[model samples]
Target: MRYKGVRFCVFTLTVFKFVNGYLMTKSPPRYVDDYDNSVHSKGKFLCLFLGICSLSYHQVSTARPGLDLVYQWKQLEFDYQSEYDRQADIDMEIFIPGQPAPIDTDVYYAANSKESKVFVTIPRFQSGIPLTLGTVTDKMYKGNPVIAPYPSWSWHRSPKTCATERIVSVYRVMGQPVHSYEIPSRLLEPRSILVTPVIDIRDKQCEDTFVYIADCQTYSIIVHNAREGTFWKASDKTMYPYPNYGTFNIDGDSFDLMDGVLGMAVEPYSPGKDRRLFYHAMSSPTENFVYTSDLRNQSIFMHDPESSPHLFHVQDAVKEVMDGILPKKSRKIYEAQYDTFVKWCCQRKLENVNEDVLLVFFAEKSKTLSSSTLWAHYSMLKTMLNVKRNIDVSKFYKLSAFLKRKSEGYKPKKAKVLSLDQIDKFLLEAPDKDFLMVKTYRGERRTQSAAEAIDKNGVMYYGLMSDMKIACWNTKGEYGDRLYSDIVASDSVTLQFASGVKVVKNLKGAQELWIMTSRFQKVATDTLSSSETNFRIVAGKVDDLLFGTSCKGKKHITGGTAGGGYGLISTPRG
Candidate 1:
């Protein structure tokens, strides 16, 4: 008894009513449209067309539409402050099966609309494609469109203290509803629930269909035989929340809580399967999984409270892979910050590859800037090396270091630090009157000591900044008899104006002391004497300068607060 275009398969006789009872009668050609087209279109007509072709083959086979169901819970654009203005948008999209590429859908739960005042909470799906959705509705709006004699799932606005009610509905493409049920809130608590596929828990009296409901917040999974009117939490520590997995606010607790445990996924299987896995991910980066055998079996988990599932440290997995690619010694030289790189690798299914090409690729793809860019490259290389372990670990590590150092060592030219006399001479001599010349230039800006110290010989030493690195007078002017010139290097340098201006050899070199003499060189060394007006300035926090011991241990009166230097000066305690 076969039809004209019928091709029978193993999966048959499980056809629930077609969504909207819409069926295609005309026996069309078997592969008229491309298989890819049917996958994206929900193949609504295609599924119906296929249904006409064969009575069997109820389930529509979709392509590798990884995570076809996308459920997004977002707050709607409405006044949330007022108790009457409770509004939120829950978007649920199901990808059309057997599509060459994924496509978007107009289908959504119209909870947060002008018509309905129902606040949807805890949406969970059953197994298999075109599954039923169970959602809890807080209440109905006062001015809703529904007339009297209200529907089965319909309820009037109740007292504020009462909990919400649940609404279960089977939805198809384009938000078409096939069947719906309104379960009381008392039967199923609405928050953080994962509903498993219908299972037959038949004993002798009757065949009972049960579902495993897991509440992440309650730290419990309940065995619910809805048919037999029985529900109880499975006595297992495995169902509880991880010690660190809970809600925490980024901004201080002024706003509402961002609940954790995004949701859970149950592996699709026949009614009576013993071994199955239930996967759950908190709001954090990590995801964990537990076996259904332990979750379902009351005897094992109930008694042994210690039994819990293995927790997967996603970042650690990436680190382990990276460790295998680099040598033990090489690991200490580089910082293995490879979380983002590992995530990218995971998404691309890039694993067990050579180090050279991958390392170069990771460095080029990073968005880090300045010296951090080198670290980014190092991290990417480390992660990529771990991506594939086929390469020799020691050889790769050596090669990685070579490539990193070679690329990172290319330093850019440093900016020139002009002497105060040179800058001051340029400002005074430059033809461009607008260059570094404000209206109140002489009144506001003046030469100021940046660093100063008195040597044991009583020579007054000081470093002066005429202006704080203002760009003016592009051409190199004449280098006057400047007090000190700082040589720009790969790192910050310590310059001393003593004798001939010299750069200190080490980073932590002795504090620079400049011998402050008269503006003209007429004053002889023998007759030179420290002035009470000469203030000793010590480099303070970062660019700041502190006025230490005054010259001759007396107060050095200044025209301004340390003149043009922006650095804050500390009062000498002594």
Candidate 2:
């Protein structure tokens, strides 16, 4: 029975193979010898052998090694079969997976296995080209990893080197050599590049063109014209040098034919238009004057000096007072009156003292006072004049009046009582022949007194000589006896005499006595009171004292004997 079963199986397999071969042969050939012509022809032949085996075998094998081999062979066969089936269906219908079987025709084979299997169909005797299996693990083209030696033709060519400097290089496209005109190094280096060709419309020929290269680095704006052959650089133009002038530059706007201009003035007649230079001028520190260049008439027009009207006229009388030519008292009065006049004239405008007018007034008044006083007065005037015109005048008026009153009332103190040292020094320094008088304090009055004696102790004073009158003064400078006395004692006395013969009263008796005066002689005497008085030498000659008879002449005396004399009389023995 096993033998019979085996024979039957073999016969069944044979019959199936015959039927499959007949069907395959009867159908139009899907591919001819061209299908096996590829470098994978060995794989294709193996696939054909596997197809025959599948049809010839009656039982399916599931053993490990057998199943594996069968699986591989089946895979190969399926590939060839799919190719044939694809070609057969190409014209009539699409060979889609899971498609319904065609009615009355078995177009696709249904597998008995539960899992679906995939297959490929190829033709025979195709071109012997190597197929791309998949990506290889290794190399990198540019920065990207590539599967093959060559990528798609769409891949952009990358630059080898890039710099900021300008450079030129040649590139190859396919097998043709392309000449790259000079290109800034700033281009290239990027993954992608955009090239724009610039054409000059002015040129009829298309030869006037340029290539603009842009990359990721920076956008370079260049001017390129075929007429110019290649490219040209475009940048800002250089500035021109300005004109020079010595101490000051010429003011462009101020220039005029008549006026000398140091600066320019620009004026615009309308908006959005060029400015016009109308006047040329130089500024002055003194606002009264403005130097200008006049181009119109070629002559300068100076404003009048008297344009400012705050000026006050100083009266000549007042000027005289300030100049000190007028007496002190007169000057004081004049200044007061002048200040009053100024205050009245200035009124409201007085607040802004016309400086020029004030200056003129000052100059005129300056002639009156001392130079020092003039300066001080001028300074004060200037300060007062600096007050703004808007300021109230009442306050300044009151102040000026107050100042004038105070000045008029001011008085300096007088000195009293000359010191003893001062008197002595005056006497010592005075000529011996001259009558010198020293001032002295007597009661509440100051009186001039003469020095009677200058002893080693201190100065002595007596009557003062005034217009030939002898006014007696005591040591205390009190009014004392009018005539001389034979014996008197006091703290101090001053003496003066126009004539040497002067009468005196003897202290011993109430009787007139005469003392003889002598020139360059000294005498010491003692006498009885009545006898001396009775025999008093009424007009005895004396020198240097009570001797001269001439009122204004020098005195002289001769030696003579006197009655009852006590001290020796020393006279030159001639």
Candidate 3:
């Protein structure tokens, strides 16, 4: 869901088929207003729209949902009369004389359900697409519904150019222009220049007008005032991907395409929490629900309660606890990278914090640093700049590509663990009764070597039950306040025991432990399913109560002196 990675220009268009079935409704293709779908006496329906293909309407059975399918609609092949007419003037032969019809013409660009008709775009990216845009009719060709050109057949007489007189081979049609909104990279920082994150505006008939946006990358719900164009990164990280369990195994090809926060809906004609914004990531199996009032309320995003309500939390210890969405253990490394970038900018008297500055900064560092180190700085800076200076560097797609190019032939230095022979030798020769327990564990547990999955501060992170929470150990050798609240799920995504843990050491650098949580229990019981979360990569901070020392080896990386450090040193501008 990265901006640089989403290569498609045109997006999906949604269509709503009301309970009566005869009442088809279409709003602006890009941002449709939330429709109220009341359950009727006719029958309850379950509507499923493809990512960018056809729509299937299902009847939610009185027995159980999805138990019985009453009807399913598919798009049939077009006659190509419009394509033939459109290509006649351009001297292009429209159809081969009795050309074999496409084995499957199910591929469609987008769809909009208007009154009485469902409009669809059939991209002429290849042949067999009879028209650029058309309306689905009740008439069936073969067994599926057939499409007729919209407006009339005359409107689509041109090629893909979309010239003055023609609109054939079209993909961007049937969409009403909605106001563009840009998400401010960082909303928590003070100096950020705000931009609109508005994506969908509520119906004007409603008393309060709210703009809703789905930020796929950041996993945030952006809310804005439609009239004023003011926006905030609301419900940030409230929408996230749950690791899907199984693969799509057909007659034998297994495949999957991962996506995030693509679908959004605003529940209608209800008050309080029932009136909600419903959304889901395509990669996830569960739908996220937040009250429309929570999304509409500006108070939640506006409040900054670090330590006290009135005063700023200036104390480092408390500030470090609450003012972070990142690993508190790596706080110093993050700050160091930020200070270096800001110092470089100050030395050059540069004020504009944008892609150009970062590109040059990273480019210079790339000379001495390996690709991993270069990326390490990039990752650190991306978060730190947003946290400290309110700068969002992720929108710099060019920089991302540049760093990717720089990493073309580079590889990370693998951390060295004990060889099996060495392990065996130590097991046989080493003299300690404690080694018995180690050998027993190696024999019992799946013998995955756990590296120093702890931090320099003698603190470790582990998951707790009852409420999905993560508590850390204090220097006093007892569990302190939970540092992080892990994502709670009905499934044991976070509750499952960690399969493996590793610190993945960087030479003389601050490190955080990585916890690999998997439902091996599901695999054991043959209950694994793609419909639910089964695997997850979680970070767990580890601290020791036993020896008053964490598992992380004592290594502090200062990167030597200014001249010998990460990048070239620059003198401050006078």
Estimate the overall C-alpha local distance difference test score of candidate 3.
0.35
**lDDT tens string, model 2, 1-574?**
0001100000000111121112110000211001111111010010000001000000110111110000011011111124564455444332222121100000111122211111111111121111111111122322222222111211211111222111111111111111234433332223212111111122233243332211111222123333343442211100001121101111111111111111111111222221111111111000011111111101111122122222111211122122323344543443454454365444534433443445445445545755545434543343223221222233444444433443465332332323233444544676746833322211211121111211111111122212112221122111121221111111111111111112211112111111111110000011112211111111111111222111111111222323321111122111
Which 10 consecutive positions of candidate 3 have the poorest summed lDDT? 57-66
Q: For residues 314-346, what per-residue lDDT tens digits would candidate 1 score against the true structure?
A: 222233333444455544333334334444555
Q: Mind sharing the TM-score for model 2?
A: 0.12
Cα miss at 368, model 2 (Å)?
A: 82
Q: What is the TM-score of each candidate against the true structure?
A: 0.25, 0.12, 0.32
lDDT top scorer: 3
Residue pairs in clash, model 1: 36-100, 39-97, 39-98, 39-99, 62-98, 63-98, 352-388, 353-388, 461-514
What local lDDT score does residue 469 receive in model 1, on the 0 to 100 scale? 16
Clashing pairs in 3: 182-196, 261-281, 459-542, 459-543, 460-541, 460-542, 460-543, 461-541, 461-542
lDDT of 3 by residue, 1-574 (tens): 0001112122222222233321111111211111112211211111111111111110000111101111122223444445455355235543322111111111112122223333444333333334545654544544544556654565554444433333321212233323333334354232111111122224444224565555444455556565665666554332454444112211112333233453453433322112434445533433334545435534435443121211111121222222223444465566667667867876787766789988999889999998998987887787655534445688899999899999997664542323234444655676776543111101110011111112333333332221122222221121121221111111233434332222322122223233334343333233444444443433211211112222112332221211211111022100
Overall local distance difference test of candidate 2: 0.20
For candidate 1, the TM-score is: 0.25
- What candidate 1 gets wrong by more than 4 Å, as runs, is 1-153, 159-208, 235-262, 270-275, 281-285, 301-574
